[model samples]
Target: MSVPAADRGATTVAERAVRRIAERAATEALPPGEVLAARGAAAVRGRRARVSVAVTLPYPTVLDDAGERVRSHVADRTAGLTGLVVPSARVRVRALRVREPKQGAEAAAPVARAGRGRSGAGRPWSQRRVPAAVSAFGCAAVCGAFLYDVVRVHAVGRPPARWRARLMEWLVTHGPDSGVWPGLVSAGAVFLLGVWLLVLALTPGRRRLLPMAAPAEGVRAVLDRRAVSALLRDAVAEVPGITRVRVRVGRRGARVRARLGFGGLESARRAVTEACEEALGACGLARPSRLRARVRTDPLWRAPTPPGANTGSGPAGSPASPSPTPDATTATTATTATTATTATTQGSSRA
Candidate 1:
């Protein structure tokens, strides 16, 4: 007999208690003390001395409740056939929910803002200041070490004052004698300028760098693994409509490769391209030569159209009729003029 939902123990405390008792009894009948937990187990007595057990469930897909129930029921029934006296019980449920979907979503939502504030607002400022400080400290340390090395060289190995005089004489003779000191100073200046340029070239930009290419070409950039992963996290969080984003960032150029998922291929491509750029830019990466964003459409994300939708009623077709094309409008005007002339001729003929 079909159990009406209203009569199936939801309406009254007495009925619910009875159902709960029957559920526990039926559950106990099938291999008790096994430490299996039921999310929402209930029981009811059936006619012909049988009990019914139903449970809402949760877990790995391999441990799906439906398959488990089927296997357990079969084993118990087989045992009954072997005279194991498996109680004439039934376990029936339309659906099993291991855990409710809505329960923990709220708890997770606030974490995003907290994380953003910590990293975006707080960490970046610290990162910017700390790196500059470290660089400045490094420069000072280098200068101090160089001065110490010069002093050590002077203290440890001084050829007689005669050697110094000979070296000076060689410079006076072979080098630009009049401007030798200035030339030496200029060379040192050039060396320092080259070192400065090299350092500037190596440092990352203050803004995030996204090196994305057109969809037709693939994206390539050298990036830190952590920076790319952070970008991917942000893309996943901020874009609600996107279904999936796959990001790969390489070292050196911060080369970015991404596969984005959306309801449609076009939208997916667009989102991936935009997200890749934003992520790279945020990390202060320069665009790479091979930056590309590939967009993939997920079959599951296809939007369902209302049944019996009119496909032809888009921009091309309208209930009000198409506006006349330039040629068509000219032809129409010519036809009207011809008709007017014909009417005048007819009137003249009648006269």
Candidate 2:
């Protein structure tokens, strides 16, 4: 079927209007929404049009509420700009932003300040002022202490403060403990702390959010490993006989560690592995990961007690009852009598 030029133009206009609306809604800074990608399509039938939009939000949002908001904005904008009655407006959230720890002031300050123009006014003075103040205070304290110590030592020809003298003495005498083991342990701890801090300072922690192959051109999507792990965990846990599950989602595959309670271990393992694979398949990940299931028998697991059963009692009040007659005493007496009879028979034979 061939479409008329006028109809094609109208559809283009409608799609463009919807796209603009989505960009505006997603870029708004007030509610902290950032649309990493957006797409829109419009269908024009005579005087009526239908618009559909899909957006990837690079942050966590209430999907239902955000979708509704986008739909409303797209419908209104499309109708106003294209002069077509929009009968349907649909919005889908393609991906959620990976949750990451907030970057320190050093990294976030520039980003926050650069967007001031688009954000209307800059953030309140309080937000920008605290970090600067803290830095200034630290510098001032260091310089002031240095000056005080220099003045006390040279200008006034006086001893340093008692605390300062004590600190110096401790550093000179006790700072390096005499024991080699203690020194090694201290050095190792300090080295590890420095390495940890260096890593944190040099690396952007949010890089763990792996980018997924986009379903559409000009669009990008990322999935959080932690979120995927949670999804797999829930799925594996639903399988019968799986009492607990832990899932670690990685770039290549997902590792599932499950505890089986009172069931065939092999069967439980197979069930959980199948369940996890199915769940990951449904997740629509760009690269489907292999499922590695490890099932362990929970030694402490016990069957659920029946409603009215008394678990505290044994079959009898006592676990075991002894015979009333003392068998050990009777046996000892018989042995003693036998020995006496043997001795008497020996004496008779001798006589």
Candidate 3:
């Protein structure tokens, strides 16, 4: 094979330059900033080529007490020095050159420190105000409704007879009553209101009890098993041709079995199967694959009326509908026997 001229040149200039730089970096233990500058200079002059570059090791920070500790020591020593900023600079181990530190290095450090550090004092208007406003408006509306109810019952109308009569009689018969009961009742009412308001304030999402609006994530309500089962039964009953319906909940999900009771096995299976599929479709599951149906057993199938028992018909009743092919019968029998055995073993274990 012939060698390419470009490959020959790469070996001569780029390979030797990279080797020299790596050797110098290893020997001098040069700081990362100087090393980076050297690498940049190499690329500009076409002395070396880097196909892949990544920091294999991280230098220590002031917060970190382990590692070689030399990086931090160097950073601290050079923090206030002139012409280069070293504290924030990472220790990159590539190419190397040494130049005298510049005159502005010390000033550069503090300015870089202030400019680079993160501060949470001011965020964008959307984050700071929108969520807070939404939560506040929701809470206020709930409180306003409760307060309106209170005012409507007490301050705006004639008080109910029992309490009103007693209060009036007491005020007329006994001049200005004095007791702790009223004060205690007032305090309890205030405490209850405060507790309720606090709960409303801390609660998330919009309040549905009163009319106010805010963008809400989602609304949820509890649908207990009894409610779900009742709904399923009602829906199935409405299917025009279905009778003799049965539902069973199993580990695999839910199994609904139904049959037309009076129809042929095939017809009953068709109607019940379609109804089940339609009912499940309305539930909107993640995928159609999640829902399935099968006709286990239908009571409507009859043993084909004995051959020649009826007045001459077209086929005179074929022999019990031709007992399923021998292979099919054997396979079915084996499956049933296996299933029964497994169930028996499981039941014995439970017992």
Candidate 4:
């Protein structure tokens, strides 16, 4: 005889299956052409599930609206497919893509703007993974220790935990009327620590990584300051008169110092400055750098004229003549050089 349906075992849905359902739902919520990919994870306990979905979206779209659409769709679809109550659906927009405008239709393309007041230019923060993991671990350890201590003291008929015993003794002995200075000092230290944590939580921490413009709206773009410095070095090296190049990149701007090989001091300085600016611009930084761009020249050690170019170096056009020696005083005045050494910095700020 066959068993009745009532006596049969309950059906179960695997967590992976729930996750796939959520991912499918999230993908379906957006236009097929626009979405690059979608992924999801689900946690199930008893008959309830919590889902999180990650998706790529177009730039300039209202993040809130896009997120909500994905969230609602995932919740409804998961619940309907598995009969599992979905209490929460988290949607993360991984990136924003800027669609290229069709040729000859550039005028019709819409400008991408950062939503709200946020500079769509990304703030590369150290996600606080360490702090969060430490916090969670701390909480778990404390709770477990407390539970173990309780069990040993009550059920097992063992002495209380030493740590707990000491803590209790301290609390019992230290009444409300403790030393004012000690309590006040401790309170002040705690307050300062809390304020410091709050500051870290609210501020973006990766100062060295600068925001850059991406092809897509609010597109995530970043360039390292050290990398920028290297590029500046290469750019200055390319200029004809520069023998040695040094570059320093900071938050405000980049400072470049180039040594002249044979060209006019003023001309070499100008060329170095131009190279620095051009290279910096090409780096595509969203904001300007923090340091100023500067160039310093040492005319005392002009490189020996190349044998090939020296054919006419003798008095300006004699074949096989001696090269005219470089005179520091004959070049631009030190006053002029000093005046032109510093280049004003502008515009490297966080988005």
Give the per-residue lDDT digits (tens) of candidate 4, residues 1-351.
999996888888999999999888887787775554466788999999998878887765888888888789889999999999998788888898975566655543224432222365666888987777886798899999999999989998999979998877765555335655655676678789778778778988788888876545435878898999899899889988677877877776777777775766667677777777788888977666654555565656564554656544356555665544566554657656665653322222321
Better of 3 and 4 by TM-score: 4
Prediction 2 global C-alpha lDDT: 0.67
- Specify the poorest-scoring 10-residue window by lDDT in model 1: 117-126
In the range 38-130, model 2's lDDT, one tens digit per residue, is 656666667777766667765546777767766776677667766778776777777777545455854764554455422332111223344
Residue 249, model 2: lDDT of 73
Q: Across residues 47-94, which tens digit of lDDT does each residue of candidate 1 receive?
A: 222334554334323335554564366336433433233344455544
For lDDT, candidate 2 versus 3, the one ahead is 2
Per-residue lDDT value at 5 in model 1:
85
TM-score of each: 0.23, 0.36, 0.22, 0.48
* Cα misplacement distance, residue 34 of candidate 2 (Å): 21
Q: Order of all candidates by TM-score, from best down to worst? A: 4, 2, 1, 3
Tell me the lDDT of model 4 at 273.
Answer: 75
Off by over 4 Å in 3: 1-216, 238-242, 250-252, 284-289, 292-351
State which candidate has the highest lDDT: 4
Model 3, span 1-351: residue lDDT tens: 999887775423454444334333322333454323233122213331331111223233222331124334333333332212332323344322334446587556446545533331111122334555775898899788666666767997944456545756765555334444665566678789678656655554231111111111132222223333454556655655556566653322456666543435565556655665665555432223133434444465353354547443347554445446899999999999999999999999999
Indicate the worst ten consecutive residues by lDDT in candidate 4.
342-351
Q: List the residue pairs that clash in candidate 2.
A: none
Question: Which of candidates 3 and 4 is the stronger one according to lDDT?
Answer: 4
Q: What is the C-alpha lDDT of each candidate?
A: 0.50, 0.67, 0.45, 0.75
